[model samples]
Target: MERISKTITAYDKHCDVYNDKFKEFEPYVQKIKEFIELLEPGMKVLDLGCGPGNVSRQLMLSGKEFSIEGIDLSEEMVKLARKNVPSGKFSCRDLRDISFPAESFDAILLSFCIVHLDGTEMADLLKKVAKYLKQERRLYLSFMEGKKDGFEKTSFSEEELFFYYHSLEKVQDILKDNHLSINKLTKQGYLESDGSITTDVFIFASKGN
Candidate 1:
């Protein structure tokens, strides 16, 4: 819990820096567009760990009218998200406490934030996400790929942030357990702010009716 708190604090303290670094970056634009293509116009979408609303902004920029609601653990990030994506609703909320109604969202975006959750917490969160997603809807997830979890410092902040790296097989099993069928899974190299390269795992899954 302490590590999580510290990670949130770091984000709160460096929200501006993080936003500046990522706001215009669109390395995953193609993947996001593919996910968007699966949905119809005027659909309800939820963005967890929305981080200054970058992904939400991309969704909006796709020229589709989506009712987007976004949440982040950092109040500062929520504030920025509201400003950046004024058409969308933004809130400060922990991922572990998400409590939206079952089958409420047409699509859910969880970008790279699952890196903070361990296996058990990740499973619980995926279950909740699956419940909130309407049947036949999509869920997008991205995370740093690895076999271990720990705290690490990034260029954005001096404070060390907790990171959880789940292997592809582990994530696959968890998605299966939650009844989310994988539609697409890909790995791409991402250059970190600290000048290190990390493998990023992206997954697009759909729920069965």
Candidate 2:
């Protein structure tokens, strides 16, 4: 818990830098567009760990009228999200505490947020995601690919943030266990601000009606 708190504090302190660095990043824009194509205008969408509203902004820019609800652990990030995507609702909330009715969202994005959660927590989150996502709706997930989990300092901050890495097979099993069928899975290399390269995994899954 201490590590998680420190990570959130780091984000709160460096929200601007984070936003500036990622607000225009477009490595995953194609995947994002694919997710957007699955939804119609006026559909309800939830974005977990929506840093600076980047994904929400992209959705809005796609010219679709999506009802977006975004939540982040950092208060500053939430503030930026609200400012950046005024049409969307933003809140500072823990991912574990997310409460909504079953099948509440037409589409959900868990973008690189599960990196903070351990294996058990990740499984629990998938369960909640499955419950909140409407039938035949899509869920997008992005994360670094690996087998180990630990704390590491990034170029943006000296604070050590806990990162949990899961292999493709593990994530596949978890999603299946939670009743989310994989529609597409892709991996790409990402150049972090620290000048290091990391293999990132992107998954698009859907629930069965």
Local distance difference test, each candidate: 0.88, 0.88
Give all candidate RMSDs, comma-separated: 1.5, 1.5
Residue 114 deviation, candidate 1, in Å?
1.0
Residue pairs with backbone overlap in model 2: none
- For model 2, what is the error of residue 112's alpha carbon versus the real structure, in angstroms, after optimal superposition? 0.2
**For candidate 1, what is the TM-score?**
0.95
Q: In candidate 1, residue 77 scores what lDDT?
A: 96
Estimate TM-scores for all models. Answer: 0.95, 0.94
Residue-level lDDT of model 2, residues 1-209, one tens digit each, is: 78789889888888898888777767877778878887788889999999889899988888889999999999999999999999999998899888899999999999899999888888889899999999899899998985468878776677778888877788889899888999888898987667878899999999983
